[model samples]
Target: MNVLSENNSITETAILVNPNLGHPRFLEIDQKLKKKKFQTCLLFISDKRDPAYIRDYLNDRIKIVPILDYKWQSQLLLERERKEKKGFLTKVKHFFKRKKKQISELLSQKKIEKTQRRLESLKSRVYRGSPIFPSILEVRSVLTHSIHDLEYINNEYCIPQDYLIKNHAFETLDVFYEIKIEFTLADELLDLFRIRNFIMFDIVQEKNGITERINYHSLVVSKNNWHDFTFVQATDLHLAQRNDRIYGIIKEWMDTFKIENLELIEEAYKKDQKTKKREEQAELFKLPLKRRFVNPNNQFRIFIKLMNRKVFRNELEFVVLSGDLIDFTLLSKLPKDIKKYVDFDYDFSNWKIFKKIVLNFPQKKRRGVIKGEELLCPIFTILGNHDYRPYHYDIRWAGLYRKLGLKLEEALAVNDKLLALPISAIVKSKRALRAYWSQVNPLNDFSIKLGNNNFIFLNTGSDSFKNFLDLITGHPSLTGLTTKQIIYLQNLASHKIQQKKENSFLFLHGPPINPKGKRSFLKRLSKKISGKIITKLDEFKESVIKKIGIKKDTRIDGKFNVKTGTVSTNWSSLIEFCKNYCNLTLAGHTHSLKEFRLDDPKGLKTRVFNAPPFSLKKVENPAAVYYDVYSEIYTSAKDIEKAGPFVVQTPALGLGGYRNPDLAGAYREIVIKEDKLDSFKVKFIDR
Candidate 1:
């Protein structure tokens, strides 16, 4: 039959139906429609089996006007019976030959007829809505834990970042808090017998970066010890050069040979340890430090001793060295004379090589970071590109520290909760703000913990940082992120806050570019676009060029680069972290001296602090942050905002002592203010 119909577009339309088809198909069709949340009338064919209860009422629900001859259906049914009743091989032959040919012909004609019929039916169509789905959803396996030793998951596309969110109806699927893991200790190398704690990273992945796992390393405070805990966190103190900076570096050992030079350094650093003890000693006879005291040899020695001492002692908890502990970046870009240096192998063993590099490393200039094994307290090191050759480009040594002799360092220093991750569990705490590339997977992440208070470190940065931050803080801060990354933050905002039972702290490399005046220029000069459409804007067309955050020649504090416009603009994710944690986010990347708070209407609540750089030089936020484990508390988001640039600025722990000391003395000594913890009186001990 031909039916003429008005169409929305200039396209051909057709509808075909096979009257001879199985009648039961009609019932299946009705059910399918209902599953789509749609309602349909039952058009019962008289010859089909109708339920006994409904049989008597068949003529009641749907209106039936007339009856039709079975001419078309009779032929279809006769063929179907012939195919089914044939002998085994005869049946197979008939199915593929005559039977197949007939079905194909009928289906082709039916499609065309149905389209035309529906088009014609449009005249009588009722505005019925919705569709139904099959009652059952397909079975999908839960995420099977993978073992680490088995190489990396190469199928980048195989891992999905987000699953279609289960609607109100629930089904089984693997639901887990995806986290990253960093292991720098070995079983053979158990370094214990000291004070240390763990630092954790709470990373979240965004929709775009879902295939690219988010690294959320949370401080694993024992549920039991959430109330009573102590740990150490680190940043901006570049520990030293990696394997490349040092001549002999392999999968294991860092020094040419273990030496007493390590001891001398330790003895000198103890001066800070004995600061209180020295108060009682004579003013003149003490030592070389005291007045602008600078002890390069002794100072370097102390840090090395700690590294070595940590080799055998694992008692201390977490360890985080944010950055700039050493300057081993080639001393100079010039190539070294392998022949000349090789003349004297010194037969230096791996450990010896590691020690020599550590002992001889230049701390005065270079910046690095060491985050592994806790000593005296948990340490979380928030490092920048300078800290470790910016992996912003490659992931060759993604787990540098973990593969070294720090297995024990990882096992003992980090709390049991995190270390307990499956051997296959590896997370990348690194989030690249640029669109160029990223190796951030679920396997790489950084962590450090302290008493009650926990400091999680994020090694999030990018090579073209300005653009990276643009993508991030144009939504940026201690970390550089992309647009999809912004969504991840939004999601994490919901989770990180919930995880906090007590006080928590943030250890990062960048300052919080909170939506303050920073975004002013972006808002004024350039055209305004909703955060939703920012990603698709034409502003992100240039390379090394930022899209927004520029107004009337005044560049906002940050800029957006590749794929920048699309990033979501909000730090609401950490709003909860700020509200739930007595968090002190210490950073030094911007090299700018600044601090602020974003809180609720109440004044006394969550505490947020930013560490001013040591020098507006290479590394910013130079002060050593000391958290008073006992007292820090959280208030409302408004309270966090009200909290002014509370007491901040402390000297750096350097060669002789902290250089460029803050106007205020050390925040507080840990040992002395042990009882003042409840009052939020934090103290920094020299030792």
Candidate 2:
């Protein structure tokens, strides 16, 4: 019989009849359910133990129902007799099995160590001559307390040092701030030495592999020390390449769902038709749709004029477009012309439209965007989730290379270049932007020095796989830095600090922390459970293979493995770096204008500035959407009658959701004084 009734969909009742499962296990289940905020009646079916035995374990929050079964008591008696007869033999078998398992575990540990050693050797060669880090000794000295050569693990790899520092730097920085000597010479020389105050230092390597430090403050000009520079940050542009493209995307989506939800699709189409009517009536003012795609020129014209006005005119340094530089993908919506899809093809028509939209910004002769006096500053950009070709396509996908009429590698190359071309061209055209991207890790990673300050720009979109996973999980700033990349950043900052830059600033598409907490509790919980299940299944498979005597060597993959790798999207590393090394970080994926000052254990604080989307139209708000598929998958009419929809609601997007009345379109002006953070002010542009 089922423990819980098949008709009980809401999990309103739980009956625990197995006494052998133990009180701890019984109470564990109770607590787990309660943590999920489930309301249920718990009943214990046992004659050996009274209901009072579990009463203390559960409180007023859970309802207790008692049912004593005499048949269960007879079953227990039979089980005890069976155990008495076979317990010794079972114990003997388990003893040998346990011994074998222990030996297997030791061999697995050895394999893991051997793999790590090989990977470390490869990294040492790849990361040799790190410009920012002169030597591993320097990084280790700064990151960890003094340790002997024998005590050092993976001394050749700087990754271990990064982990040590990332884990404890915030707490250590807090201590300095608590003592009120955080900025003093001792504290400055120790904690802030490489991250901040070191910009004046020059490293001179001696013949014995020791590095001598030299300060170059005298060689630097006084005028260059001028700290006042302002830059604007706007994120999540979601620029639609063309007005027609939007209609096409929606139409395709409606077509896909027409058979199942015709009414819903029809309603959405009608809404689109109504919007078109409204757009015609409001010709005097730009429609939101027009502003987003059809005529962004006028919208951008208004914004440029505002920025060029008397109050803001002279203060602007440059503009940073955080992400979502485009709308739609290469295989946006599969073409409906084909009955049976044999191959995937680039939606060239959509690409052409997108190209036109991007060209409008760069073509000097284009009419709308460059209408008034153009702002001469360069605009630096990073890709958002939408910028890439579709990572997940329907099963009908036959692969883009076959459909695009190109070799697999050629198709991939074309996609890569096409996705990045517009931003690349824009960056190349501006002298400032060109110089910025040219420095250190020339691809999507860049570092620039403006006077005494260092700025780092990361391509969060490059880690497409991790980023895609993050989106499905609703994690903010899911793009993670690679261990090699983190070390490069460390070296970059080290050099900048040695050059006497006041502080380093990081620019990226996603905020390090989710502005809103992980949106769906159920999704997160399910992900956790699924991850555990996958891990166990992998282990089980490995064990079965070993039992069959099929041995395989353990290997370390190139990608950063969150379980065994150095860097992750944990934000603790970013926070620790900012708290100890860098000054302020600017991000904008959430499309909300907000400032965050994270506090350490002490009074020390690290600042994060979040920018609102530059585009007038709203993107899909992740938090506002309600998804019940996870809960629904486990419940059906037979499983839980009258369970409603088994819906799971996420936290609503506060100011960032589409069509929110309060979203007046905003940007932030960051003021830097003496290379240190001065203030970040949000400037709202009301349409």
Instruction: Identify the candidate with maximal TM-score.
Output: 2
* Per-residue lDDT over 115-196 for candidate 1, one digit per residue giving the tens place of the 0 to 100 score: 3333222211111111111111111212322221111122111222222112100012223211111222221111110111
| Model 1 alpha-carbon miss at residue 356, Å | 6.9
Give the worst 10-residue stretch by lDDT in candidate 2.
174-183
Alpha-carbon lDDT, every model: 0.27, 0.32
TM-score of each: 0.33, 0.37
* Best lDDT among the predictions, by candidate number: 2
Q: What TM value does model 1 have?
A: 0.33
Backbone clash numbers for all candidates listed: 161, 13
Segments of candidate 2 deviating more than 4 angstroms = 1-226, 243-301, 308-312, 328-375, 390-442, 462-470, 473-477, 498-501, 518-571, 602-664, 673-676
